[model samples]
Target: MMNFHFIWPLSGGLLIGLSAGLYLLLNGRIAGISGLTASALGWTSGGVSILGLGFIGGVLAGAAAVFALLGHAGLTITSSPILLVVGGLLVGFGTRLGSGCTSGHGVCGLARLSPRSMVATMTFMIVAAITVYVTRHLVGGF
Candidate 1:
């Protein structure tokens, strides 16, 4: 039997919603992590550098706090380190190609009822399912 921690996902969704809502409300900007990270590179004194940094910092700090309190949620990764890096790079590339990520499209876009985001989100999910099936069941047995 698989054990599921429900509050973790719920809290994550709340934080994502809160972050996105707050950013839009305060700065009149859409809260996209990729865009924020990319723009942070060209960050000047003002113009959301602090805002972006604070939002991201809060996410990291929150994760650390959770781990510290929970004493490691006991998750493990089976993929090799190199494969993980390559997979991350590929996902980043795909996000750039698609103009957003699962979080941006699936969460915020779906919330706003965007047709384009709906298509993008569904396409990404289908592709992800196919990839996982092929990697784990097909090629994984080789």
Candidate 2:
């Protein structure tokens, strides 16, 4: 029998992929969350993309809906506040340096067969594995 634990995540992944695919197909834009955020924040020369704002709003709404429905019963934050802040900062820096986030590179870029996205995604995965190993074994506190 199949494990029920995977069903929710599988459904979420399908929804994400469908959204990204539709966004790309309709808008002719890559659904890179970082880029969208930057554009929405008016950091880009384009001066506040409406599409970016809409995408961000949709993501937030979806997350809110999920939380409302699920009520955070199984949710837990094991990391300290400082750790989480630092991790968020690092992720922001990494996303900027990488030119895109996982959604853009791993999902959309891979679907489009982009070489840069491919490399970025591989690097992200490798670095994540190394970080996990170090934190869990070498560092001993994470």
**What lDDT does each candidate get?**
0.81, 0.92
- Look at candidate 2 and tell me the lDDT of residue 38: 95
Model 2, residue 19: displacement in angstroms?
A: 1.1
User: What lDDT score goes with residue 102 in model 2?
Assistant: 98
TM-score of each: 0.85, 0.92
Best by lDDT: 2
Candidate 2 wrong stretches, greater than 4 Å: 1-3
Q: Candidate 1 residues 53-118, lDDT tens each?
A: 776787789989999999986788877888889989998998899998887788778888999899
TM-score of 1: 0.85
Model 1 bad stretches (over 4 Å):
1-4, 43-48
**Predictions: Cα RMSD each:** 3.3, 1.7
